[model samples]
Target: MSLRIGQLPDRTPVKLSVSVEPDLACALADYAAIYAETYGAQEKPETLVPVMLEMFLSSDAGFKRARKALHARASKGDT
Candidate 1:
């Protein structure tokens, strides 16, 4: 399912805060563990969250098209 989830870009880190249920937290932790094992580098769940989110967003074709349309409108001073 995540075959297209490529490596995250190397960039300056930013901090963020979010709240999730215990089960979701555990699931993120599990994903972090698998990500570490898969890539041979351990990462905290905090780090995985953004990378996973970016991967999810980038993989959505409809979202990408809509985002491009929004950008085009914004560039043209349209909302």
Candidate 2:
């Protein structure tokens, strides 16, 4: 019973600490404000940062290719 979709990945949450330049911090705050206005829901910049990063990583074709290659190598027991 092969399925097109693979098994779901782990959903455990990990906490990360990051530092940004003042200007970038301001930009994140502005983005959060715009997002709140667009969606009618308020979210802190900190809350949005990880989601934005995940979306960015998911959208990168090169990253996807490299990740796939790494997974294939790991599956093959290649160091």
Alpha-carbon deviation at 37 in model 1, angstroms: 3.7
Candidate 1 error regions (>4 Å): 1-12
Pick the lDDT winner. Answer: 2
Q: For this target, which candidate reaches the highest TM-score against the unseen true structure?
A: 2
Q: Against the true structure, what is each candidate's TM-score? A: 0.71, 0.80
Clash tally, candidates in order: 0, 0
Error (Å) of candidate 2 at residue 16 is: 0.7
Q: What is the lDDT of candidate 2?
A: 0.97
